[model samples]
Structures are given as structure tokens and as C-alpha cells.
Target: MIKTSGLSYAALAQAVNRLGYLAGKTLNYSKSAVSRWIAGEQPRNPVPELLLEVFRKKLGREFTYRDLGFDIAEADIEIRSLWYSDLSTTLDVAPLMWSHDVFRRDLLKSSAVAVGAMTAPARNFLPFEPDRCRSRTGSIPVSLGDVKMIREVAHQYWRWDSKYGGGRFREQLVYFLHSHVAPLLGGRYGEKVGCGLFSAAGEATMFAGWMAYDMASLGLAQRYYTQALRMAQAAGDRQLGGEILTCMAYVANSAGAPDDAIQLCEYALDITKGRVPPRVQSYIYSVLSRCLASAPSSPRNRPAALTALNAAERHFARPLDGSENAWVAGIDFRGLQTQAAHVLSELGMTGRAHEAISVALDGRDESHRRAVAFCKLYLGMVHVKEDDAEAAVAAGDEVLNLLPGLETARVQQGLARLQREINSLGDTDPIRTFNERARTLGDRS
Candidate 1:
């Protein structure tokens, strides 16, 4: 019997895809080919050599034929041993169990210990307590290693996609979260590990929701967010729960449900009252401000926005302890300022909006290409409003330069809005010509 690495199918698939893509193949071999190899049909002649070459290039390592061996008979036995033999349950769960190893190479190695062939559900698959695990675990109970790895991957995707355009990766992440991780939530673990798993799953689910929102799939995003909220409740992580509620409010506000947004934000604020870091509290308020801005004009809306802005200001005025969640670390006061600028702009408070934009721009890190694109768009919009076509055009051009790097949908939407504004000024103006150029660049790219 050939003793191979015992890598899960997904890892090998990822490796193959990476190799094929690097080699510039128009259409690489199907996954079935690898499936066949794993099924114990020995690669004869040049194909075996080709496999070695592909793996070496893909993984940056050398391998002997023996290194990739597996017994044909054992393939089914090994797979069934790793997961339950029940096809129905395995269909629902194998992906999620295997996904654990996807994030951590060591976990995959450990998984090769092979689940017991007792014909019963694995030890990890606990009975689903509908009442207890109703929503996201309130407090995560899993090991620190799992928590850290999930966070690292989530943050990496968040930052990278925000800077580079979600494109196919956005879809890939959503699929993996839904297909490869959801089943683990159904499996058993100790209370400690269970809570931790729920927390990590909840966070990953929320991130999937964010990507959905970026793709303009509001309905799907809502579902993912709801699932995330449930996972948070299961983890018993109130802080994370509150944060996710605030995120849900953002989705609501974006979809024109300001009233819904306001209610959700208030609920989150109440839930986290006094327990959360000031940074989180500030974030909640910033989101609330968006709700207030979008709400129908009334004394209540004005006062609400003002109150939220004031509270955010007070929070930012204080020095944050280093213990805050890393996600909320750099959330400076400019976020509040940006919110103010947006609201003022909507209210036709042009001077105030411009002033706020200036302050926000000053505070923004231009190194973050997305932030620069946003600032430029906002500034351009302000100029367009003021009939400063030349200035608007200049700002729009800058937005175009950064557009190649910006992956956020909001930036693209902002650019479209600016283009409309420039277009309203007629086709012959220099501003119109500049807008046309920017539009072409985006369209062509």
C-alpha cells in the first residue's frame, strides 16, 4: 500500500488549480482526473511524471510517486472512516469537517488519524439542542488555535477583497462558508469547544454576508447575517452578537429600511450597554447616525442623529486601551466625520458637508486605496454640487486612477453617481470630457 500524505480532496484540488492557473492552461484537467488518481488507478508513464511536475510547481516541493500513493481499496474505507459512512449525513457534513483542515495544515494531518469505524456518528457530532444552540453561540468555547486561524483568514479576505475587488473570490468564500463549514455546527464538541466553534462560524458567516452585500445580493446577505446572528447567540458572545446586530442594521439602512436600521441599532446599543469597549459603542452610534440620516426628516431624526454623533465624538476623544478588538482598532473619529458629511450632503448643507469632508479627508490614510477613492468621490460630488466642474473633474480623474485597485461596491456606486452629476452638466464641457474618460477607463477595465 502506498502511504501518501492523506490530504483531503479539497486541498489537493486547491493545489491542482493553483498549478494549472500558474501554468497558463486555458482549460486544465477536470477534478475527476485527480479523483481517479486517488481511486488507485496508478498513473502510467509520462502522466505520473506530469503529476510530479504539477505538484512540485504548485506546492514548491519535490515528491516521489510513492509519496502520492494510496491503496484503491482503502480509499473508500479511509474516506468513510474519516467521515460517517452514512451517505446522507456525509453528504451534508463531509465538506464542513474537511474545511477545518483547509485553514490549518496541521489539522489536516491530525485528521488522518481516521475516525473510528464504530458505525455511529463521530464523537464531535453532538445532538443538536434546538433550544440551547438556537442562535449563534453566546460565548465561543473552542480552542484558541481555531479562533485565531479563523480570524486571520476572515481579516485577510476582508482586507484583500476590500482593496482588490471581490470578483470570483467573493463567490468562492460564500460557497465555502455555506457548504464546507455549516455542518460542523451540527456536530458535537465540548461546551468550551462548541462555543468557540460557533463564534468562529458566526464571524465567518457574517463576512460572507458582507461579501453578498458587496455583490448587491441583499436578500442572500440578509440570510447569511441572520445565520451569523444565530451562531453568535450560540457562542454566547454578547459583544460579537451586538456587533453583528449593528451590522444587520447597516444592511437594513443600505436597503432603504431606515426605521428597521434604527430599531436594530438601538437594540444592539442596549445589549452592549456598559459591557462593550467604547470603540464598539462608537461604531454602533455611527451606524445609528446613518439610520437617522436616511429617516424621514423630523425633529426626532435630527435629534437622534445629533445625539449619536455627539456620543461618538465623546468616545473618540478618549484614549482607547489596547485591548479593543483588532477590527475596531483604527476606527478613528473620521468615521463619525464621514457620516456627518454624508448626512449633511443629503440635507443640502453643502458648506457643512464640505467642511466635514475636508476634516475626514485629512484624517484618512491615503495609503488605503479604498479610502482614497472614497474621499475623492465625495469631494468630487461636493464640487459637482457647487458647479466647480474643473475641480470635480480633477477629483473624478483621481478616483479613476484608484478604481483599478478598489474592490468595494460602494466606491463603484459613488463613481456612477458622480458620472451622472457630471453628465447633467451637458456633453461639451471639459468636465464632461473628463467624466467620459473616467467612464471609459472603468468600462474598458
Candidate 2:
């Protein structure tokens, strides 16, 4: 592996040290240390993990310690099994994942995003046969009321996530899933009740994934999403499954794999077409528009993005009687405009982007603080794209004001992008002031 990678021992050592520094450690391994490792000497804790991360990034793939000829522990095997495991194994692994995420985050946080790992779940879901018999034998008896409670809790968590950001209640949600929900999966239940339980579980698990994404734990988020997809498939809930895929597409696009994002969105649209409510379809198209806009700039992509955005707007315009799923309730006109703003901004339609984001921000109250912050950030970006330094500064100031109460990595990432855009315009007085203020708040965050 070392020879094929063409990385000299010193380069390998340097890469490992860079990862260590990012993790708040001081590593000083010399070229000889790398040679010793190549000569069959095992390094200490974190070195093995760091080595795997370095190779994963270098080769654009995932690697386990066992793959690198290091001795693999049983716990490591279980930790790596969630993404590709069968549905039954996934039920067993989900709780373990939550427990580890809460208590031993280092096991998962150090891992790099494996783009390949996302492919199998999306592909396997296309032809998945819903489990016919969901009956399980355990101590506790499950009921529809229990499923309803889980759904209610998930809805509350969604509200909290929108208001305070994903980092605020993520651990609490994970604990609830582990302590309360996982056991219910094992408890005795008939087929109908079992389906409801799995659907509820899928929704809760997808929230976990969204929290992980907002916290910038991309790899961990993918695992949660994969498990959620499995749960949705088991429940025979294609609409929910498609929603999960839409989320996976968003993550993929954010991680610089827009092609994967586009494919996932297409799969989502394919599976959910005519099967879901107009609100849900509108939500899917909104995401598809964003993904299409983010893809490599081409003539085809621009028009395709516009078309998808139009579809989203059209779907959202249709009348609704408030009978949509709990998850689809949040996909309102403001959210659609927010997505439209993103699509427009990515396609370089600066004026349209500004208008769309302004619509998104209109009448935004305290309940949607995080969403408002994101819109402001994007508005700042659009201002930069338009070379409007003063407006950009104002947008940055608004984001700085909102930064204190939010715990989302995505908002911080947006601020960073805004900074980059400002920097590209050359340093000036207002830009300098905004940068200084942003730096101060960023340090605190």
C-alpha cells in the first residue's frame, strides 16, 4: 500500500502529523517511524486511526485497521459494520452506534467520509423487498401509542433543531433513541404495529443523521442515514425512504460530490413520484434543484436547475388540507424560497438569489432562527457575488449577531465561505471590520 501510494516515508509522517495537529495532538514521527510501521511495527493509539484517515483521503476511499494489516478488535468490527449490514444487523447495530456516539465519540469522529459507502445503500434500496413479517419476540409488548409517542418526540426534536441548531439537543436525542426507542424495536409486536414502529424509528434516526450533518460529522451522518434508509425500507414507507435519500444527496453535494448528489436526487424523485403528497414532492424537487445547481456548471445543468425549481414552486402552490406526514409539515413556502435562493445563487443569478432569500427571510421569527441565519449567510454570499461590499458587510453583521445562540457547523461553514468571498474582493475598510468581527465570534464558537 505504501509503495502504490507513492508517498515517501517523510511525506507519510508529515500527513499523519497534520491530522494529529487538527485533533489537538502533537505528533512528531520521523521518516524512520514510518519505515518501522512499514516494516511490520504497530504504532500506538490514534496513529493507526490517523494512518487510516490519511490513506482514506489520499486514495479517496475508506480503510480499516484490518485492511492495513493491523490487528482489528471486535469493537472496531461492529463500529464499521453499520453502513453495509443487513436490515436485521442494522437494528442490532443502531443502538450500539448511538451509545458509542454519546460515550466514545472518538471512535467515529476520527473517521473520514467514505463516498463509496453511500452508494450501496442507495442502490440496494431501489429493489429492496419490504420485510413481510416484522414480529419480534422480546420482553415488552409494543403498541401504537408507543409509536405515536416516538413520533411526537421526533417532531419536538425537529422544532428544537430548527430553532437552536443540531448541536443543542443532539446528545439528548441520541440517548432517547438508545434508551427508549431501540428496545421497542426488539419488543413483541404484530405486523401492523411493527411497521409503525419502524417508520417512527426511521424518522427519529434520520433526525440523528441531520444532527450529525449539522455538527460536521459527515461520516457518522452517512451511517445514520443508511440505517434510516433501512428502517424506512423495512416499514415499506417509500416516501420516507425518498426523503432520506434527498438528505443523503444534500450531504453528498456539501461534501463536493455533486454528481453523487444529482444521482441520489434522481433516485429520490423516481421512488416517490405520485406516491407521496404534493408537499413532499415539492420538498424533493426543491432539494433536487439545489443539487442540480451545485453540480458542475454547464448549459444543461443551469436549465435543469431552473426546471426543478419551477417544479418545486408549482408543487408547493397547490392547495393542501393539512393531512401530510409529520415530516412534510415543515416544507412551507419560506423553506421552498430558501432552497430557491440556494439554487439561484449557485447558478450565478445574483439578483434572483437576493430576491429569493429576501422572501425566505420575510416574517421569519425566533422559531426559525437558524434558518434565518442561513439565509442571511447566503444573502451575504450573493452580495459578494454582486460586488456589493456594504450589503455583504451588513449580512455578515446579522450572521454574527445570530451566531451566539446557534450551535450548527453549517452556519459557521457559510460564514467561512462569506469570508473567502470577501477576501477575494481585496481587503477594504468595511470588509476589514466584518472580517475582524467574524473572526472574534468564530473564535468563540
Candidate 3:
């Protein structure tokens, strides 16, 4: 692989560090470390995933751990097949993945897993039979009532994650997964109860995955989401599967692969067409718009962005029969408008972006403190585009005030971008003042 890619050990180390930073981790492997790996000592959990990513980009092909001579004879195929494991197999792996995440396994720390490996799960589910997931149990006994309790607990975790941040209770979800849910999967049950149990576990896994995403634990998030997608498909919950696909899209876009983001979003839309709640459709479309707008430098991407933005708005404004799932219950017109504003900003339509951003900022819910902080940064960017330095600083300052104790990757990234934009305004007093403040705050992070 190195012979074809012509990448040196130092370059490999640099690429690993860059990926580590992007994943919000501190994987600073040295040039000697790469040399050691090349000498036949297998790289650890997330390290293998990262190296595969480097060679993938350098050679433009997909590579696996086996290609790197890693011994997988003792590895769990179910966990490795996280994208689309079968019912009992998926249940077996979900608890283990949570355990790995709780323990911070090497696999959980390497965010590069999502770089190329996430797409196949959605494709795997395209022709999935959610019913064939039922399986025979071993010893103890599980009841439908037990499944209900799992669902209830999962919902509570979701609410906590929503009101506070995922940092507040993400670990607790893993605890529940390990302590309560794992044993139940080993318990005895009929087909009906089996499906219900898997569905309940999927709920917990999905919520836990989203919390990981919110807390910016990228590798863990990828592990959880891929497992959750398998669980969702196993239970025949197409809606939940689509939701998992959408979450994957968010991670894809964040990792600078807009094409992966677009693929996942489109897959979600394709699988759930006319079958999902309108609000869910709105959420998917809104995410799709963001992915499209991100690539607006291309003529094709610009019109596609506009089209997706319009579609999201239309879907958001569609009537609901009040049967929306609890997961998408918070995806309202307000969030739609906020994303629309960002898309417009990405498209370089300053007037429309400013107008949309202002609408998003107005009548905002204080409960969504993070959203408010992000929108403020968006406002600052808009002010920058309009050459209003004073207004931009005011908007940026508001963001700082709202930023205490919140260090999510998205928040830190937006802050960094805002700092760069402010610095570009030269050595003026206000710009310099804000730049220093932003730089200081950024350094602390």
C-alpha cells in the first residue's frame, strides 16, 4: 500500500494527528510509531481504522484491517458487522459496543471509523427483512413488560440529553445498556417478545449514539450508530433505521466528506418515503440541504442546495397527524429555519442568509442553549460578510457568554471559524480585541 501511495512515515504520522484532532482526540503517534507498525506489530483498535483511512485517500480504494496484517481470529464478527448484524447477533454486539464505549476502548477513541465504513449499513438495510430478526433465547426469561421499561428508561435519557447536554448523562445510558439490557437479551422469549426487546435495545442504542454525537465522541458515536442501525433493522423499525442513517450523515458532513453526508441523507429519504412522519422528513431534508449547500462552489451543488432547502421548508410546513415519533418530536420549524439560514450563508446569499438567521434568532427557546450559541456565531459570520465589524463582535461576545462549560466539537469549531473571520479584518481595534479574546478562549479549549 505504501509503495503505491508513496507516503512516508512522517507524513503518515501527520495524517493521523490531523485525523485525531478532527475527531476531538489526542492521538499523537510519532514517526517511529508508524515505523513500528510497518515492522509487523499491529496498530491498536482505532489506529487500524485511521491507517485504513489514510491509505484509502492516498490510493483511492477501500482497505481493511486484514490488509494491514492485523490478527482478527479472536474478534467478534457480530461487532465487526455492526452495520447490519442479525437480530440475536446485533443484540449480542450492542451491549458489547456500549461496554467498549464506557471503557473507552481504542476503537471508541478513533473517530476515523466513520470516514468510509458507515455507508454500507444503509445500503445493507435497503432490502432488509426486519421480521426475520427474531431468535431463540438461552436461559432467563424476558417479557414484553421488560421491553416497555427499557423504552421508558431510554426516553428519560433522551429527555435529559435534550434539556442538558449529552455530557450530563451519556455514561448512564451505557450503564443501563450493560447492567439491565444485556441480561434481558440473554433471557428467554418468544418471537413477539424478541422483536420488542430488540426494538427497545435499539431505542437505548440510538439515544446513546446521539448523546455521543452531541458530546463529540466521534468514534464511539460511529460504533453506537452503526450498531443502532443494525438493531433498528433487526426490529423492522424502518423509521428508526432512517433516523440512524440521518445521524450518520451529520458525522459524515462534519468529517469533511460532504459526498458521504449526501449519500446517507438520500438513503434515509429513499427508505422512509411516505412511510415516516412528516416532521422526520423535514429533519432529513434540512440535513440534506446543509450537505448540498456545503458543496455550493459547484454549479450543480448550488441548485441542488436551493432545491433541498425548498424541499425541507415544504416538508416542515406539512401537516402532522400527531403520530410523530418521540425521536423527531423536537424537529420543528425553528430548527428547520436555523439550518436554512446556515445553508443560505454557505451559498453566499448574504441578504437571504441574514434574513433567515434573524428569523431563527427571534422567538428562540432558551432551553436550546447550544442552538442559540451556534446561531449567534452564524449571525457573526453574516455580519462579517456584510462588513459590520461592530455588530459581528457583539454577536460573537454573546456566543462567548453562552459558551461556559460547553466544549462540544461543533461549538469549538464554529468558535474557531469565527475567530479566523474576525482576524481577517486586519489590525483595527475592535477586530484585534475580539481576535485576542477568541484566540485566548480557543487556546483554553
lDDT of each: 0.60, 0.83, 0.76
lDDT of 1 by residue, 1-445 (tens): 1124454555555555543333222234455766788787774333453455445545656555566773222222112222222222332333443343234424323222111111112111222221253223324333556656776777777666556655436655655555545544554456666667667776776776676566555544554555566566666666677777787776677766677778778877877778778888888887787689778556689777867877877776767877566666756666567777776665556788788888877845534566657767878878878887778888888888886655667778888888889777666668667867876877776
- TM-score: model 2 vs. ground truth: 0.83
Best candidate per TM-score, number?
Answer: 2
State the lDDT of candidate 3 residue by residue for 114-171, as single tens digits: 4656586778789757766476657988899999999899989886765566777878
Every model's TM-score: 0.65, 0.83, 0.79
193-273 in candidate 2: lDDT tens per residue? 999999999999999899889988887787788889999999999878989999998788877878888898888888888
lDDT of 1: 0.60
Residue 132 lDDT in model 2? 88
Top candidate on lDDT is 2
As for TM-score, the candidate ahead, 1 or 2, is 2
Q: Which pairs clash in model 3? A: none
Candidate number with the higher lDDT (2 or 3): 2
